[model samples]
Target: MAKNPESPNPSLSESPGPSSSSARSNGAPASAADPRSARSAAAPGGGQALSPGASSKHTLSARKGQFLISPRRVPGMQAMGLQPLALNVIEDTLRSSPDIEVIDTVGPKNIIGVLADGMSESPGVLVARMTDQKATVLHQQAQGRLIVERDHPLTLGDSMPLQPMMVSWSAPTSGQSLDISVTVLGRDDAPVADAAVYLFGSMIPATGTTDARGQVNLSLFGETPQTIRGLYVKPKTDYWSFYQTDPDIRTDEPNVVGLRPLADWPALANFPQNQVYGWGQKAMRLDQLPNQYRGQGVRIAIIDSGAATSHEDLKKIRFGFDVINKKTNPDGWSDDTVSHGSHCAGIICGSDNAFGVRGFAPDAEVHACKLFPGGQFSQLIDALEYCIEKQIDVVNLSLGGAAPSEALEQQILRAKRAGIACIVAAGNSSGEVQYPASSPNVLAVAAIGRLGEFPQDSYHAQTLTQMVDANGFFSPKFTCFGPQIAVCAPGVAITSSVPGNNFAAWDGTSMATPHVTGLAALTLAHHPDFQNAFKARGPERVDRLFQIIKASSHPINLGDPSRTGFGLPDVLIAVGLQAPMGMPSGLIQRAFSGAAQPQMMSAQPGQSMMGMQTMSAGFAGPYGGFLPPYLGNLQQGLPYGYGFGRPGW
Candidate 1:
């Protein structure tokens, strides 16, 4: 590996541009030549006890913010109150104390914060600055708040709470303890381990993941035995998340719950493993695209769990990094244990090798940044910095979170300034768009399904809504909605590569996002407007890319703009071409020989003779299903501390 990110990696097809800085361990100072390294430096004015390596784990619990204190915002300003914040006062205070590092100026006396504790004096020293300067800090007992100016306000809240740092945590020392033993079973009474079991009563559910014997032990504290109001079982893979309401149960013995299998309902049904591509490729018209426009010269990144380099279709991907393990992990970004990233990668860049599924931009350069299975906000910032340093053109964020982070917002803005277009998933919670996606700087995408594109017996039918347009396209019931959605794409029954060289069909807004990202890559690499915009690398290039996508989109009658934004962005329209006149052209595929190859456009709904895959009640794979809706890392982050709410499988 090169010591400097700027030095060419022998494996990369094209050398990365002169980066602003090299990626280093958390908070280490950068060479004077590269200033972008300042994005995450946690060096407080005076050195103290904590070392960057020493504080690495603890830093995951850090926080930051800058509040505006003006006359109108101050207490009793008209009568006899203290004056508002001034630049000189803030600077002097920041200079005199070793707790805060001044980031940038919003206005006089109003300094905007960038990231983690700047002062390395101690573990929480840098974040404590928020308390001293403007923000009100809180600890384990209650959720914290850090005032932020909303770029685009929504009806969700009057204030967006600062995700707590979770500096320290411990369970209640004294309380009425209750324990429940449960067993999870799959189709045919097979054991289901790693399945999350939540027992909902009058209080928040007591949660636990089942062990290999399909057993889980859950304990909660209260006054006495709590009534079993509901039992929800969520398996990690290939099973429908199960929910049961009010039933007879005894805490004395094992409680059993059964889950529906995600696929192979009729046994040996031909999934994408036998097909050339998934339905998404056809809906985005990727199947009909010119063979030559395979996202050549475009560099893309998947900032999710990780990509399986060993996956046959993903052999061409040569670059990746483990953000959570930058100082360690030994190039393990390619070891995708979660399989979510691999699936998304296959959708974006899988090879058209004729044996497995095809990707939208099979030839584009892909760099996977491992940030999930376990990742924090600070780690997310580092990943985007790596993107900027690597000059990545398109970023696919299949993850999401409920709370917004100012540091993340700044880092994303920095990437945009460097001309990177970030396309994110509108969540699958059937709620409003999640953060990052909700940020105005990035493009947010929702999920859409064609009426007959997937099997009716499959769970993909569960997502089918009454909002189907005249063209048979409809907004999926599980996709998050609101004004933030930039576009919609095929997210139901999306078949792509998983780990172990096998392929699986799945669904989610996570699947929908990559379609747009893959299309963005094609436009950037081949569009004339994009070619010209690259001349002067700035925010304008990003703006142009976004404009072309929206302007080229063909509207759908999904009823609400919040659900599908401008609608599905056409590949030809996006790359400065036109949709064929008169009637929709049959899939115009072409081999390397450049010969026209017409193919089936789509499947008719309810037309199949028989036997498909999966139970008719839910979605495809784990987290990929619409019922449980991959909750991202929300449960892990709790009161807002760590892990992106990845809307992924």
Candidate 2:
């Protein structure tokens, strides 16, 4: 690629030119010194190169694909042409690094193919075993070779304790000696002769020594029970017991064996959680919901920062557009101008894997549409337009600026016109509910603490003074409060996959936004008919689904209009699939009688506050041993109603 002199010095995506203030806010230093100028002396052609003495104490790193090679210089070589010396230095350093093994040089191939040695800590090792993507080692100790694969079950902590091979077995007999044979093979598949063997059966002694053919025979005597078991020929250490055995009388079942802990079978958290960002073994239990709508065919567009498409969790991502760079880097580069985009992607459709965490709709495909790194109104508009052009079903916008732009608002309206569901985050500034969300068309999500705690309105500073923390009942210190917020979910301590196959936890309305996006995917999956119906009815299908979601929320009146928009969104209710449970008829009658405003009700009622509605039968009333209390300041205000005007006795 020859240089385009007229092009901007730094390769930034096409965009409305940034204002002077915007550049300053992005931390651009005002200094005009060209650091590369000093390098000319080191090159034969007067090309730029830094002298060893001139090297600054701080060395900036350069990343190419998965490789993270630091600053260094190498003598020019004909083998690599006259490429930057830094690239060769990094390659050489990686070759010697214990944790990395260069499978091949990409320069000659024009295509790079490399794998991470998860078993080692090489400075240049790129792939990680427990990250969003998983790396499988071809041999033990992760030393032989590595392969980056998509199977989620084979993760860092997964191990096969026993190797497949043949071992002899003998049932116990009364007053008769029991004999058994066993063999252990090496990588060559050849037997290791003279190995020790231990035979164990119910009420029988186990002992043995192997012959030259790698065969071992064990004899035991006792009122041998029908059940029998066996163990390896040799023990690794005297302190650690070498043999294991189990006795099951049934001929069809194999005997059970137990190994004593020589060392704790290392905990999953200990196995480089930093790589997968410690997404625990458990993923979001979508099966636990009312329906398991496998999102096999749905495409959800994540319009934010670029995604780590190569991430083990997101191997199925489809690149939509690079509104910023104009060029496509589908593997989502770690050099994300903003991190919010990636975080939102993880929450919506993060790959379900053994080593890392899972997403609500793990099977749904992703379309990475990078728009705003730090909230550009125009970029948001561009991304919305891009999603509409692509016909993406779900568009997740996790970034929001000061206010909604008319252009941005109209784009959202247009998306709804085209049957796209837009999920926008309630801004984190604790400021007023911003655009898109406030536009009444977007599903505006607010941040809620682990136990439904939301920040009190910061605007009412004088009123906030009267509130005091008790039982840790106070709202999250930073959660934004507003009427624009539709629902809330676990926004704090949200862990997701990050670049470099690592994990990080972040909190914001940004975190809450993905839950809604994921739920929408599931909704679409279950009700594909709804989508078809939309095609028949045109854009109104967008609001129809929105109405379904709004009608299904766990309503709570927080007194303050700016806090919870429609109450907490109930996914099951939104999708019309709540399970049936028992309820009291008298309670239901009283609830409706107490209501003055026209009420939309479910077919039944239950003691739960989720997934069921009814003017007659089943109503959620605190089933599952816990009842939702009256919503916010409403409990203190109107004695007859909880919050949101839900009738009370």
Candidate 3:
């Protein structure tokens, strides 16, 4: 009998063994004892026979209340466009049979058939009718090449008994209890209270719940140091959820885990003043450079949920399309029902007006491609095709799925072949980079946060002091990490425009992706050759762009290269400008060493004491003095000397 490709019932293996530490101490065997050992011993050759009246030698039996039909694939039918025809024959034959009702199709090849209650005493008659109909169709259209068979009844002996297994790891002890602290954070970068965190691998596994500060402390009672095999967050009714970490965490420094909420934004706060030049812009040194190229003539498309077309800051939106609704004109379809698309668009090209926040590439014309409503694989393909047809320079895809789909991958490759550069989020799952981003042709961006920076604050001071030995600036707890990461950017507590002409701070690798997209536009606008290569769809265009971005990035000293990639990108270096002196080097170490600080003369020297005081206060804390030269000297302040209030985005 042919098995269904999609519904194969592979035998289950025994559960895993217990933690290594527990197994060693208790002298337990490595494998779990088989629960079916007794039955196998009694049965001859471990082969059991079916009960009487259940089945016959020639035909398989069905359950007393239901009938099963298994459709056999016709070789070469798919190539001839006859696969749909086979399905139609099955449906029509089942519908025409007396008291026969088709329930559903199952399996990858659509081979399984479920029927409702009818002829409960005998299903052989129904099965024979289905077989005859299938044979007749094949004879008429396919020269009787195809076949159909009745599905066999599932017997008790067909499946193995499930055995429980436990995971274990070895731990060496020092005869001292280890104190460990853990902080759980939400995707928004806020503390998650009351969520349970479990610690396993030791003889006595410890567990605790996070408090108001989203922190939990654990004390291991083992005699010496031991490995922890697993650390997981127990599922709860709240908004927080967690993913298991690999190479289990040791009982050393406090661990920080980020949990994603059901919704991106749980609440909103009022927009603050001093909104221009957000930390993201400052980190890339956009404030100090000349505004000769703000992506003036670049064409970029943000393919996400949708964008707020009428928002004051998003007036530069020149074109819009709804891939989900299949609409060309903006009416009703192009509006951002979910604020994620609007936020990403704002980061890329929010208007440069004085009233609201400025975007990275303020003059770039952004096109909104809505795809979130019916985010099917086909819809994503259509969106990519649209980008190719329109010759879009840059496509900001701040969305992705956990599993890679071949159809989606083919579309991304098609876009690459047509010279469209895609910037994708590495996901917020804190694991492997998600699909599309994981695709080599696309640029995958990881998220980073300033050390000790809080989400509510307007400006995340660039305190590289703590990150001196580290590879990147911010190692956001939630951002996914892997070798596919192309670059790192500010993705934590990032403030951008929402749907209602309002501004809010959001966090995710989604937010980080647009920073690269906006910078790519600036790079292309400044270098005409790169733009020409992009338009010509040169094979080396994407590779060359990746090389340029990496070449311009500042080194982040992370233990895992997969996490930070080539560190953070500097717009100055990317656009052919001289490298800045204060690009997150050893400034913080020098400050703590009592070294002479760099000075800058203010327009009014005496009027700068307040700025100096603010800088001093920021440096005096535990996360002190790592500010770069541009932001270090508070006396010079913002372009207009806008006090020490949090710098805006």
lDDT, candidate 1, at 596:
10
Who is ahead in lDDT, 1 or 2?
1
TM per model?
0.57, 0.44, 0.50
Candidate 2 Cα errors over 4 Å, as ranges = 1-287, 290-292, 327-337, 372-375, 451-474, 528-532, 535-537, 556-561, 579-649
Q: Identify the runs in model 3 with alpha carbons over 4 angstroms from their true place.
A: 1-274, 327-333, 455-472, 531-535, 579-649
What tens-digit string does per-residue lDDT give for candidate 1 at 543-640? 67776676556666666867887678888877877842322222111111111111211122221101122111112111111111223222332221
For candidate 3, write residues 169-230 as lDDT tens digits: 44545567767788888757788776677766445666799898988997766623345544
Number of the top candidate by lDDT?
A: 1
- lDDT of the candidates, in the order given: 0.60, 0.44, 0.54
lDDT of 2 by residue, 603-648 (tens): 1232222122211011112111122232212223322222221221
- Give the number of the best model, judged by TM-score: 1
CA RMSD, predictions in order:
19.3, 25.5, 22.4
Better of 1 and 3 by lDDT: 1
Which of the predicted structures, 1 or 3, would earn the higher TM-score when compared with the native? 1
